[model samples]
Target: MGPFTFISRNSTRIIAGAALLGLVLPGLADALRPFLGYCVLTMLTVSMLRVDVASFFARVRRPLPAICAGLWLVVVFPLTLLCLAVLLGPPFALPLGLTIIFIFVAPPPIVSAPAFAMLMGLDGALVLAVTLIGTVVMPITAPTIASFFVAETMPISAVDLALRLALMISASFALAFLLRRLLGPGRVAAARPVLDTVSVVVAIIFALGAMDGVGARLLTDPGLTLGITVGSFAFALAQMALTYAVFRPFVGVDAVAMGYAAGNRNAGLVVAALGVTQIDDMVWLIFALSQLPIFFFPMILKPLGRRLVAAHSAVPNARSLP
Candidate 1:
């Protein structure tokens, strides 16, 4: 309990430290490699444990904003990227560009997006609600839209892909419900720090495990790997800024929360859904490199998030938020 509470209190340093560990110790990362799947499932379950069910359900009822956000992520943005690729043609580097664009169209936001938002002082319920809304719409929307662009590059049938998403998500949510019932909602609410600590521990393990070959890649292809790393940060930050800008007027302060959700998406979900034993190293590199922002952004943006959340709380007419 003491250690868990300490971890909860100092999660920012701990999480950033985890990223550093992954970069410095490739062997440790490889040892934990097999636990990546369990880490994800734990992240999803722990994320649900802290969410405000009432707020989640309210957003579920009035879901227009979530629907619009999902459309932007999976459909509109991908189409826009496709158009740009067509206009620019050869110099645009279609293969890499396609990989970049595929980030947005991948399943929902990360399972722990809500946890990240809450850690950064944003509204967790809003993020969770919007994310699940995206998930419900993903199976049909993702594969249909990706088919137009990805085609043979993905090499998976639409039906199997959808089923993979369903199974993983269903299992996580079911586990969440069972845990909640066993602990009782009141007890869980009272032990929030422990839950936060669980999220921190799992996230640390995840960051370490996901960086298996990234350090080696850095040694081998320093320039190219560095360039891709830069590109990954650009994609995450640019999408977050763009999403915040587009939705702020309509959703008010809640848009800030939406921006975090929009930018830090779950590209890994696409890999899991593809159901193949292996994929292209380049594609996998892009996906793995992408986790950097997702893991580190809460620490980086903590101050800005504090200001935004403070302003959101102060303004009465902020609209459509708890």
Candidate 2:
């Protein structure tokens, strides 16, 4: 098979491997460090390319529930994290590594939520709806949340960030449109594999850099490093559980998929939108650790998803039977 086709076919395996490989390849991290900004932008633009704007607006016509879900994700969820941080006091809220706090304040879920939702037999359309709304709401909400928690340390003020975010997101959409226009829609559509291959490569590069110093930090301060790592996993699962619980009655079967996006925030999107080129290793550690649930879930979720799918499949049959 051609390299692009191969990559597209095996992207999940490659993505999973990339996360593990990052732990061992700090050199790859160094090589990719300078280009981090561009890498972030490239990844964001690629995501924009996949967005079906027409379909999104069509979905928007009667999307009150999805809009609320998106609001909860980008606004309420981050505020919730901040409240928890306050209640828990200083021990849980490290100044440099506000890991859990960052989770919600960051952008929406990774661009693959719709695909992941489909893979698990969940509501891909709901996932897409929330994702689209979250992206639209992010520029305004991101800085609002970040300013409340990290104002002094932030590189830019909330207003500046809001402006930058607006420009960057707008430019990305413009870039995507320009590319499609230049290449033509059919040609662009035909290049899905190629675009996916590029995204995979960008993700691999990002994973490696993000994991830089993580090993040495573990060696130097096993307690802190391991603590954050474990806590990230725990909090991630808890977020998913809580989200699933809260939305179950209302959203039904889609709760699992919504929770899937809820727990895994796309920090990379925040990094890109915030225009932060260099992040501290402590911060990077959080970014790296946040990735575990996202990368590993697909492996473990299949059986659960299968069971859920089976249960729902049997429901209609049961109803139809006398």
Candidates in order have lDDT scores of 0.75, 0.72
Which RMSD does model 2 reach against the true structure?
Answer: 3.7
TM-score of each: 0.87, 0.88
Error of 1 at 239 (Å): 0.4
TM-score of 2: 0.88
Output the number of the TM-score-best candidate: 2
Candidate 2 residue lDDT tens string, 198-309: 9889877776666666766777888997888788778777877888777766656667777877876777766655544556555667767777767777666757876765
Model 2, stretches more than 4 Å misplaced?
Answer: 53-58, 97-100, 103-105, 273-278, 316-322
- Residue pairs in candidate 2 whose N, alpha carbon or C atoms collide under 3 angstroms: none
Task: Give per-candidate clash totals.
Answer: 0, 0
